[model samples]
Target: MLAKFRQIKTSYFKLLLLACLGFFLVSLTLLFIPLYISFQNSIVKSVSSHSLKTLSQTSYSVEFMQESANTVAEQLFFNSTINQLLYALDYNDIDTIISLNTLNSYVKSTLFIESVYIYSSKTGNVSFSSKTNGSGFEHIDDFYDSDYLKTLKANESSRFIPFPRITSNDKLVYSFLLPSSRSSDLMFSNSIMINISAKWLENTYKSIGNQQDDMILIIDSNGVVVNQNAYAPVLADLKEDPMIVRILNERVNEGYFLSSMDGEKQLVTYTSSPETGWSFVLLTPYSTILGSFANLKTIIFAIYFSIMICGIPICLIVTKRLYVPYSVIQNKLVDLEVRYKSNHMVEKQNKLHALLVFPSPFSESQVLQLKAANQFKVRFDQPYSMLLLQIDRFADFCDQYPIRDRALITYCIQNISEEIIGKVVGAESVQIDRNGVCMLFNQTSELQTRLTPLVKEIQQTVRKDLKLSVSVCVAESGHTIADASQIYQTARESILNKFFKGPGCIVYASDETAKKRAGHSEYQPARQKQLTDLIMVGKFEAAKKLLSEMIENLKDAHYDYFSQIILTITLELNNTIQLLEKANELTLPFQFNTFIAKINNMGSVEELLNLFFRLFDEMDAQLELKKKSKNEKLVQEIIGIIQRDYRDVNLSLESIADLVHLSSSHLRRLFKKETGSSIADYISRTRMEQATHLLLSTSLSIANISEQVGYVNSTYFFTLFKKAHGITPAEFRSKYATT
Candidate 1:
């Protein structure tokens, strides 16, 4: 038994050696190069796709977080408790200790505030407290005082005031200011300061998740790193990377770059909080995620080698069986080819390889002669109508289905086409194009009568069976394959006509109607003259009437030229009316009503024509007056009252309404109708204008400006200013120097 087993093993070893050699040869000839290329392409595509998805997700998360932070900041900046505390301190009736404690407690509970401080400009007193320690002003010189406080006071409309500083403990902190709500006439103005801790920022960064060793950082508009998880990186070190610096300065929301810290390539996604003027960044490393695909390549290679080894013996076994049958099939195919060439007739060719060409009816004599000489008969001689069927929004359909599913959809369409053609006029060849299917039919006069039923049947098949919608266009019977391209063009026109008439209906192409509609003259000169006449005198009512009349005339005549003319006139009239209304609301000292009256009273065509030129000049003058009077005061009585009672804590539209002896709603309506601005907007604008002058000229701090401008909360005041000016008061002052 042992000797017999050894003999069998020797025979198996010889076969295995032969199989290995064949596998190596086949691999070298066919599989290795193509398989390696396909593998590499798949790996690169997969990595790129995942990278893009990760970048997109990271960008969305950062934007969402930044928006949340801005909302929280806005709420804290507008809180009334901080406003009252600052107001009391500015009045000098309360001690700093009491105000600071109240503010610190409010900050701790209301916001994620870690520390609070109050700085006074008059007494040079600064009070500060944190969860760990409480401190009072030790040396007046120890506090860094610049024009920053004065600037903040001057502009009461700013919300978040960012200042970078290194604390006594040698840790970087971002200090935000909340100015006091006190009048500029007061001797002192108090400002609330909040110190943001790195730990507090850790809470914001926690949402970014772990993306390798890459760290998330928050930076201000000035490129200062306000919060970073990485250790000991200065503004200069952060700016060393050009992309990071660009993101900080330009507020680019999402991008990719290489880090300077470790020289590792990364996809960096960023978003700017327009409210705070700070940027948030999320950085992810590339190699950490894409490296795993390398292992996949090794596995693919092993499977490919095994397949090649197994395929060698299988090919050897199949070759013997296939040789005799393949030789017989090859000889038969050669004989058929020779017979087809000698006959020179498509019908004589084998069924599998036959090509069917529909000959033109115009060339019937020559086609018949060729067919008869080759022992083939003409299939049909009657005139035929053509139908073009197409799907709407085909590109959208392609996007919804995967490639394999799309192939199935095409196959289904082909099957349906065969079924329809077989039922109507026997099974015929159908040509598929990018838009839809093209079919030829032999029944000439019956096309118009039978087309409706056929179309209904096609619609039912597509909707009920294939779950798709299709539109069909049919050409008249006089058309044939000789005029195939022209017939197709007519069918396309018929489909477009359905867009105007309604959908799921068939249209027959009429050459006479098409030609008549195509050659009409366009009238432009008369329409232009009419529009110019109405706009010059600001006769908006008459202009609207003339435009409506023109549109009706275009529709009645069914002229494309008139339609174009009416569209142009309507657009011009709308724009002119809007301009005139805007000018009147701004209280420009121009007689637009008088000019309109003159245009309306014109008696002759010549006079009306002359008015067109004069109207343009008058409209131009009104626009100039508008630009000059944008800040003009038509309602001076209301303006003076608002300025006087601006510091009143209960000051509002209602209070002003009572003082003026009118109802609140009535006053608001009248103000907006005459001024083109709502009551609240007018008040806010007045306060902001006053605050701007004070910031540039006065020595008052931000708190005084807030009270002087009628804002009970100085932080609210700053928030409003930053929204208007696109920067904090201190930054605004640095940008624009006052003499």
Candidate 2:
């Protein structure tokens, strides 16, 4: 036995098998045992919770129905028409008509109400309204469920309790009785009865119990099954059932228990509603309740055994391949260490970028990795300052260089920054974006006198070496490493307005502006309105001028505010053009979506302004083209109307505009644009020429000639004719109309 044991210990396969078996046993004990125990407990809790939730839902539905019925009853009780009808000793046909209409409206408006009935014991009058029958007056003794009055009188305390009733039409409804007043006059008081739909209640229960073995029911305090999902008849006594007897005897408001019903063990949950004095009960079979959990347990056991059978041999094979001599492993590890150190630079830059750009606390493991790599040669324990170097005219630069050239230029810029800033202080630099590189270094007192000048030097060197200008934004005074990201953000935002400041400029972000940036820019609605109007009128030059003014005004604003203003302008302009397009005035000149995308990719405010001008020019040309084609037809139409209506006395601008279906002001502009004269001038010219012809060709008097020319005031016509031909009408005829 000792020889066999020694051999087993020395054997790799046997030892591997033993280890795998022990690990499987220990893992199953630690993980599956607690999981199974918790699952067992949870199955019971889950079943009870699910059953209770379903019961509560059903109870809530019943309560909602009850409340709806009561609301209808209250409306009838307070109704002035009903009140007037009830108080009158004799019925006015008008009051009865209005009360019936009012009750009909109440019944039709409420979803749960099958009908509404109003009774006056004093006058022995009855009025009822239903969904099927509009409304009518009936004798109190002939009304359906008229005996409910006696029941209401008997139970004076039951103000809004519902009683099940079968109507004369053979429809089952739950009727609620509500008196007009709370005064102790039940014997003679008027009352309103609201009947809730029994089918709707049953449907609510049916929707809750979708499973075949599930049964839900609503029982009143008297143990009558008022509502049920089963085929059993409602209003039947369920108190004889053992489950119901036990639930009532327990007297708890809500609870669940296992019980045998219909010769099958089921989980029964019940909840009592205080509003309606009804208990909602749900019974789900025990097997169905635990069915999913039992399946889950079986799946878990199958997965466990399958892993044990499949994992052992695979693990052994993999371990056998991985096992090697110690010397060879040591040599391979040494080679891997060299390769890891060689490739860790990029990873270090990413880590540094995260530390500076994302303001999150680092873990100890992360800090230790940085310490071990130690490639960037920067320390985070001390205070630091951040700088953002953004390429000036970045869009132009991208257009000028290819991908490789751009990358090379970026590398050169970083190298220059490292050489320049690192000589003065401990520094680390990383390219954070395509056009921007960020640098962090130890803070010094000479931030303003020393570091600022060095940043300017770096900017100049980049411009000189790479022929590309860069704008450098330096953050505020010394800040802790934790606050590096905040300062970096400030610096980054400050450089966004490089178009306002020229290339190769060094700007410092002041603490005050950094805080003030949080404030919003004042929306210039007046200027925006002016801009929109100008664009609509096709005033390209004026719109361009206004855009320049806007850009200038917003030069000192925060980038967020400026970008929002630009977006607002685009949205408002697009909306206006869309409205015109809807009116068939003109189609959109440019694709608005593509225009907006170009605006977003713009590198500077000038680029944005120029793009706006381009859009304006396109829109202006479109408007001009449309105007030229559209105005000529409208103007000729106007001329024809003037010549035809010259004999009429009311040939005015507004009248002609109505004929042409144009606004008076718009017609005036259009005619002037086409004829180079006013509508009034054209009318005068037409009438005066006719007056001249009449004077020359016919033997008509001046007043007759004036009347023939559609002039009601002859004096005004003569004065206008004299003004036109430099003479009176007769003299003009004598001078120019003679043969």
For this target, which candidate reaches the highest lDDT against the unseen true structure?
2
Q: Please give the distance, in angstroms, between residue 5's alpha carbon in candidate 2 and its true position after superposition.
A: 52
Q: What's the lDDT for residue 13 in model 2?
A: 54
Tens-place lDDT digits, model 1, residues 1-739? 9999878776665565565456567665467667776666565455444444543444344444345434444443444333333333344334445545555665566344555555555555555556555544422355443333454455345434555555666655555665543345655445656666555555545644454565566666666676645733645346655766668655344444445446766555566665456666656565654575678668877877787777777766654444235676889999999997766533433210121222243354643554467443223345556666666446666778876886677557656865775565643334345546655556635544666787778777887887777777666653323554556556665554343233345555664246446664445557666765776565645754665455444432322343355456535644555555554532122344554555334332234335544544555565555433332332555777777766666778898788778788878877787778886777787788888888888878888888888887999988999999899876776667544
Evaluate residue 473 in candidate 2 and report its C-alpha lDDT on the 0 to 100 scale: 83
TM-score of 2: 0.42
Report every candidate's CA lDDT: 0.56, 0.76
lDDT by residue for model 2 (257-333), tens = 88886677787778898888888787778788677787889987887778777867776775465433466689999
